[model samples]
Target: MLETDRLILRRFHKDDWQDLYEYLSDEAVVRYEPYGAFTEEECKQAAISRANQEFFWAICLKERGGEVDPIAQAAGKLIGNIYFQQQNPPDFMCWSLGYVLNPRYQGQGYATESCQAIMEHGFTKMHVRRIAAMCNPENTPSWRLLERLGLRREGHFIKHKFFKRDAKGNPLWTDTYLYAMLAEEWPVK
Candidate 1:
């Protein structure tokens, strides 16, 4: 598990289905995502699936008090998730980063904090040589967050892919902005 002053990044648990449903069910939250809002049952399966995947991290809020309690903090609300996965070819030493957060918990720096923690973990512990992220061109907030994390905007692909279909069941193609950072380019903090 990884800890920040206000957050904890740990493997997902099957019991976190309820918290997963809270955000995954919101259309606005999943707007830029590949899939549409998820049903409760989908969230349940998602939680279980995430629990079995090492790349997915459950971003939880750390309980605050006079003295931080690890046990209580571990039970804190599951506000979001971080997807940090190694790309193909083990010799490449590259990884991909992605994230989603509860709309209610946004506007604060939780997403930033959680992402930074994961990037730090990838760079220092996992020996990741490079990390990349992709976001829809229309997702300003998401790309902005990527910039805040110090990833350089590398490319812009036109009609890259489609996640959802149109009213007539046609593909809704969208542009994508690719962002990446090399280990040597990582800000020395």
Candidate 2:
């Protein structure tokens, strides 16, 4: 598990389905994502599935002070998740980073904090040589978050891919903005 000032980046647990459903069920939260809003059952399976995956980290708010109940403190709300997975051949030492956050937690620095921690872990502990991220050109918040994490805007692909289909079964192509950072470029913390 990784801890930031007010966040905890930990692995998902099957029982976290409720909190998982909280944000995943919101259409706005999944707007730019490949998948649409999730159903409760899908979230239940997702939490279980994510629990078995080593790359996904559940982002939780660190409960503060001594006024809260012990159980509540132990089980923080799962605001979202961070996906940091190693790319092809293990020899590549490259990884891809992605994230999804609840709109309620938007405008705060939790996303940046969790991502920074993951990047640090990847570089220092995982020995990752490079990390890359991609997002729709229209997702300004996503690309901006990438920049805040110090990743350089590397490329802009035109009509790169499509995640969803239209009512007529036509592909909805979208442009992508790629960002990357090398281990050597990471700031010493």
Candidate 3:
């Protein structure tokens, strides 16, 4: 598990299914995600896939600080998730950073804290040079979060991308705003 001042990051597990579905299936929690809500089967696959992977850790809270305490929360249960999809020779010249916090946990500055930790991890541990986040224009919260994390708005692709939809189904194309921060531009403590 990855620990922050008030949070922890770890992978998903079978026990997380009920809470996972509780938040993830809630449109408010995943409204901006690329895909619609997941089925039980999808959630199962997700847990298994994430558990088997080296990356993919759920964000939990230390709350009171203890060893072996699943003290962190998931998708805003306590904190939220911060993840990276790395590239050997990054095609886009960056790793994609994604996070989702339950609406009940919004505006608490958890995303900012979690993101800051992961950003440092990506640059220092992963030796990444650039990291970026993509969000729909309508997702003001996410956009604001990226900005709060110090990523500059780099691109605004209009209707070039789609989400929660398929191209074959009239493709409700959506505008995607790309925000990025380079290792050199990262703030120094």
**What C-alpha lDDT values do all the predictions have?**
0.92, 0.90, 0.73
Mark the 10 consecutive residues where model 3 has the least summed lDDT: 70-79
Model 2 spans with C-alpha error above 4 angstroms: 64-69, 72-74
Q: Rank the candidates by lDDT, best first.
A: 1, 2, 3
lDDT of 1 by residue, 1-189 (tens): 999999989999999999999999999999999888999999999999999999999999886333565677778888999999999998999999999999988989999999999989898888999999999989998999999999999999999999999899999999999999999886644
Error of 1 at 27 (Å): 0.7
Return the TM-score for each candidate structure.
0.95, 0.94, 0.83
| List of clashing residue pairs for candidate 1 | none
What lDDT is reached at residue 170 by model 2? 100
State the TM-score for model 1.
Answer: 0.95
Clashing residue pair totals per candidate (backbone < 3 A):
0, 0, 10
Which regions of candidate 1 are displaced past 4 Å? 64-71
Model 3: per-residue Cα lDDT over 88-184, one tens digit each: 5765457889998756566878788888888888887877889988999898988999998999999999987766555567667889999989999
RMSD of each: 1.9, 1.9, 3.9
- What value does the lDDT take at residue 184 in candidate 2? 98
Error of 2 at 131 (Å): 0.7
After aligning candidate 3 to the native by TM-score, how far in Å is the CA of 54 from where it should be?
3.3
